[model samples]
Target: MTMESATDAAPLRTQTVAVKSSFYLAMRILEPARRDAMYAIYAFCRAVDDIADDEGDRAQRREALDQWRYDLDELYAGRIRPRSAFLAGPVRRFGLDRADFEAIIDGMAMDVEEDICAPDWEKLELYCDRVASAVGRLSVRAFGLVDDGAKELPTAPKLLAYHLGRALQLTNILRDLDEDAARGRLYLPREALEEAGVSNHAPHAVLANPALDQVCAPVMSRAREHFEQADLVMAGLSKNAVKAPYLMAAGYRSILDGLTARGFAPPRAPVRMSRRKLVGALLRHAFL
Candidate 1:
């Protein structure tokens, strides 16, 4: 299907939300069909995420997520709901994996099951894979990095999804430490917390601990390593093929740098990308 047709057929709400997202520009730089496909995927993700983050009863939220899973099954079975019809074109055109979509829903279920406290390293990795890497898997397909008729993803793009997904997610976990704590969640791995002398696993208590920065250091280092690995993988690909990933990496790396400079001390100043820096990244990664 043509980009214009696909985009116009998309739910208006999805279009609006995708346009408003921070990654809009990065997505916009893509060829039309890919860009529209990405918008659809982003919309799907945002809808599930909203359900997970809703302040309603947990059972109701889980039910809502289940509804999405049902919708996805129907979608794959050649049925499409009005709200999700946007995905039909992309799913068929890009050969988007059903498992990746299901993984995203599973990740949302994790959030809804309970407020995650200090989870073990394994659980944390699983969460990152489901929530972030799964999305990246879908996105890489949308980005046209996956080969047509290929049964599996190419090694480089798959690795790109793995490393970049974890990098972006870990950066998010570090940047949102205080915000997540407010919501009674803490994503820092228990191993890191224990190693840093943060005996209290309570969200707010851990955030208040002076050792919080100590815990964040290893996570930050891991993020940097992932970013570096993603960079190395992207380095071998054509720039056009990896433009969106490059832009995303640059933007998040900027945020990581800002977080590093700001530190995790209490009364923490918000770390945000300045307009100038954002523009620079856009020019460098998207237009250059």
Candidate 2:
């Protein structure tokens, strides 16, 4: 089969529909071909992430992640077939490369091994690479970008995906800082804030401290860097793939802007996009 044919299989659309309703709704803004691969990757990623984020026995989460990894190994090896449930069918029907799927599993497993918040920037990047970047790389595969020999091209897309993931994660941090800290997780790097001469020692400090903006200046700067990096990557992708990420970026950028406008307060309100905004994104994807 031709490269385009392989990437554009109709099964991808069916898989997109089978994913979690919210994700499927968000991804529907993407072109059908792009949406398909995105759905399959997201379905797997969501499953792994749920294991980490879900409220349950810690031992149960660890056990579930272990089983997930094992299932991933089996799926890649074609040892035991995955039943056509949720988003599994698209991955099989599209012949998505196993490497991207494994990377996602690797990233989720990393999250399960420790706290959601890491102590350093290096660890944060590692986390972003595994969780978010891995999905982006899989997206590149679905977009039909391949090497000279028809194998998937990896490096450029990998870097691009990594930054986009970082930007999204940073947005998550800003939006959920309070909630995460309450759970004994602080995603903000202590070193970075100290270097900026701002304190964030307590769960409510982000909302309580008068110097909140000062403390967040450095963190926002870092988020801006990742945001810029994501913009560069957006320019590099095909038109079809760009729309979904662009919409995703718009929402994130709004959070950053909203944080600045609110004096960098940790989210006191739910972060959301209005229906009008969602519709605008849908129209843009359809017409532009």
For every candidate in turn, the CA RMSD to the true structure comes to: 2.4, 4.8
The whole-model C-alpha lDDT of candidate 2 against the native structure comes to 0.63
Q: On a 0 to 1 TM-score scale, where does candidate 2 land against the true structure?
A: 0.78
Off by over 4 Å in 2: 1-26, 31-34, 81-89, 92-97, 116-118, 145-150, 196-207, 274-288
Instruction: List TM-score per model, in order.
Output: 0.94, 0.78
Question: Lowest summed lDDT over 10 consecutive residues: which window, candidate 2?
Answer: 1-10
What tens-digit string does per-residue lDDT give for candidate 1 at 1-288?
332244455745566879977678778888888888888899999999999888789999999999999988778877677667788888878889989999999999999999988999899999999999999998898787887545699899899999999999999999888888888899999999999988989998988899989999989999999999999999988788888888888888988999999899898888865566667877776554
lDDT of 2 by residue, 120-223 (tens): 77777776676776676666555544332234556666666777777777777777777776665667776666765555555555456666666667677878
Tell me the TM-score of model 1. 0.94
Winning model by TM-score: 1
Segments of candidate 1 deviating more than 4 angstroms: 1-7, 286-288
Report the Cα lDDT for residue 69, model 2.
65
What do the candidate models score in CA lDDT, each in turn? 0.87, 0.63
